[model samples]
Target: MNRRDFLKLSGLTAASLALTTLRPRALQSPTRKLNFVILLADTMTAANLSLYGYPRRTTPHLERLAGRAIVYHSHYSGGNYTTPGTASLLTGSLPWTHRAINLGGLVRRQLADRNIFHLLGSNYHRVGFAQNLWADLFLRQFRADLDTHIPSPTFIHGQEKPLVSQFFKNDELGAYYALDDFLLSTHHVVNPTAGSASMGYLGLFYGLSNRDIGTADAEHPYGLPSNGYYFFKNSVLYDGICDTILDLHRRENPFFAYFHLMAPHSTYRPTRQFVDTLVEMEFPTKQFHPLGGRTNRRTLLEQRKVYDEYVANVDAEMGRLFDSLDAAGVLEDTYFIITSDHGEFFERGEYGHDTPLLYNPVIHIPLLVFAPGQSQRVDVHTPTSSADVLPTLLSLAGKDVPNGEGRPLPGLGGSEDGARPIFSVEAKQVSSFIPLSRTSISMVKGTKKLIHYRGYEKYPDAFELYDLQTDDEEKRDLYAEDTVTAERMKEELFDHLADAEKTLKK
Candidate 1:
């Protein structure tokens, strides 16, 4: 039977057991396996964290936890954007192998026929709670096996809330209400009537009314109430995820919880308290990116201030989560992982992820793995990719991924010894206007790094080599300067690519 079918049957059997009386045998404890919690942040970069030596103390909790965890300092993402990065993480395979680089792309069923979630669901209860829409899309693919999928309700307005159209006297103006108009016009598949989707519609209506649908203020009610404006950085999402996790932890059944947070991503508004902290610290204001054809410097600065405040706010919430888990005495028993899907560029000529640049600021992410009773702080210098996370997690869970592109992380108990060269790929563009014909691939082995560009006529077959030991910032392109080193790195990268291609064919 497929993984989903097996899970359904097992869940039924598990429901009949007396959970309170059940306890995992000593043989099946940490030595054999343990529960897992992967906290994924959206559009987060390690460069901005205090753990990575950033000037700002953006991640005090992560830094404190790093002492007890194995931190992979040189970890990278498999893809430039969220969809591809997350898919690679879940499947433990490259984008080419997974084939889920774009929005509607499906993962290769042959190589990773069953994802980590599916595999866990077969043996354990799997639940996913995501705060972002993109993560919801990813979780939707495993709806049958997923025990629960809770989207962030921070910005949502219940249908019980009055509609904006009710305030308008003119019928035409009332019809102009974006939320009411869209809901009234669109065909509802599950519930044909308007009330069924009222909560969703009201959220959109209020969001549009305040002109803060996609901004930090979306978390606030009516975009008013100074205290409410800081809701984005509040512990709402963290609390929701923690409650779900605690619930699963209390259950006798083993469970896998994927908590994806939307904090420190955008709409950088932090709580008033956090804002006051930033003001006291007098954080430096850096115009990382220019306002492209815009004349809103004052507004933009205010937005950035909010963003900094939110980061600090999230850090505080993270502290709370750690404390709660420790108080529950399950902190060490849980296999905790913390990482981000992708990093935000803050307009440095790039406002978000999916940028053409292959800089560390965009792809380099913070990866921390904490196993139960494991105190060794091993820093893995060998380049690692997000694609390796799934297989690593599976290996920890006493499972196997036969054709996974990623290897189990080293230093972890029961981890294998084979470490392969890591590579990352980004499709140049998705739209015809931006020329979707090119591909950028980055390969790293030891201190040598190479970036290869294919299909761009001007830079076609161009390669850039860098000795990360000397130039970590990647400010200088050594491709033209060091021909011999570039050629060697290029050949090695090509060989790795060829092997990946062969594996895909098989």
Candidate 2:
């Protein structure tokens, strides 16, 4: 069985009834206030988008949208996966500080209050929704500050599986860990059963009953796009998002909405129209890493092709969402920010971001800010991190920027600082409470990148350096060849890590 079937069979098919709701009201909004809308597309890496000079025209809609937006060319995620990457965006801190390093982890309790929703204060109406259950955990964590927390399964087909977070709304984070992650665990890498014999038997019958629901249709040749637990149509999802925006517009207050979608993530299910219609090209074959499984190059390329088509399908839906919102005048007074939590990978004998490798394909995500009334496109070539988003949004809301690892993004409330060191961490194996003993840290300053792998049996304390300006593919290892730059960057990286470790003592 595939990942989706396995997850469903792990007893994630429980019935959920209760949902959080808010009263609908109508009043005139403040004339001078600006609404902020963050449209987060999960696993949307810049490595495959045409807007970022990728050979494939997978993101034609984004390319058109970029004409009236601010595009950052070298934006990186805080981590290689959803938990840490999303936590960094919400808290304006790196993985080391927030410590949401594990697969189903949450930020440190002490620093939990320092989130975007809480930082935005009570002035703006906050609405949050996420199809990605891991990303939705953060929304649940910050639900106290949210005026509206849309259910995770909003606007999907009726037969789709409901989230455990929805079932135990009062204790979503705890319930997810207890019921989903522990008792009914089906993550192949993490836990197959974990002694959940009863639930496994129950889920077997449930999966058998719902097996027909996953069959392909004429519209969807492969199958409906799924978030591992449920299937959903992109058209329906975008429609719901548009309707939510319109409803939010009717309210009296300016709003801050974060809609994290799970399209183009995995199960690479593109609509029939998008299948086999994009660019046909080849990527450079690179040396395989011990951490990256031994998936053949042919299989990787085939997976990449399907993934590109899925991305294109999502982009088309985005185009439709933009059109509908623009027609309703929602785009006129809203600062729409488009980005992703982390990225996907189909290289180096790997097919996804599950591997510990922190290469560009898994960490380099797209960042585009469509400011209110923006007419021309502006490009920022300087490298930026996901941590910058929280502080940047606070600045846009006229709030004081908090002291954190991130600064206001350039051209928003701050100027470009080329020397600023941006970092992405991969530490799923590390504990949230202790020091990062096992991690992969990638530091990028200017056009140079240094990747440090620690606590791996295959490669202990290894470092790989590359000048991104000269070798974007990272084929050349400059660590031994360029000792001066390597030593300088190594010192800075270790010093930063040392400082971050001091927090565990407190």
TM-score (C-alpha) between model 2 and the true structure: 0.92
Across residues 1-506, which tens digit of lDDT does each residue of candidate 2 receive? 76534532332221010000000001123356778899999999999999998998999999998887778888999999999999999999999999999987888999999999998988889999998989988888888989899988787763443245467868877877777666765556766773477875565566567656767999989988777667788898999999999999888888999999998889889999999897678799999887778999999999999999999999999888887888888877788899999999988889888988988999999999877666666777778899999998887777888898998887776666779899999999877888888899999998899999999999999999999877899989999999999999999999999988897668
Model 2 misplaced regions, further than 4 Å: 1-31, 158-165, 185-189, 194-196
Off by over 4 Å in 1: 1-33, 109-112, 151-233, 276-308, 346-348, 413-419, 428-437, 457-459, 502-506
Candidate with the greatest TM-score versus the true structure: 2
TM-scores of all candidate predictions against the true structure: 0.74, 0.92
Candidate 1: tens digits of C-alpha lDDT, residues 94-165: 776676666434455564446778876556778876555455556655555676655434433222223343
Q: How accurate locally, in lDDT, is each candidate?
A: 0.62, 0.84
Error of 2 at 10 (Å): 54
Per-residue lDDT, model 2, residue 152, is: 81
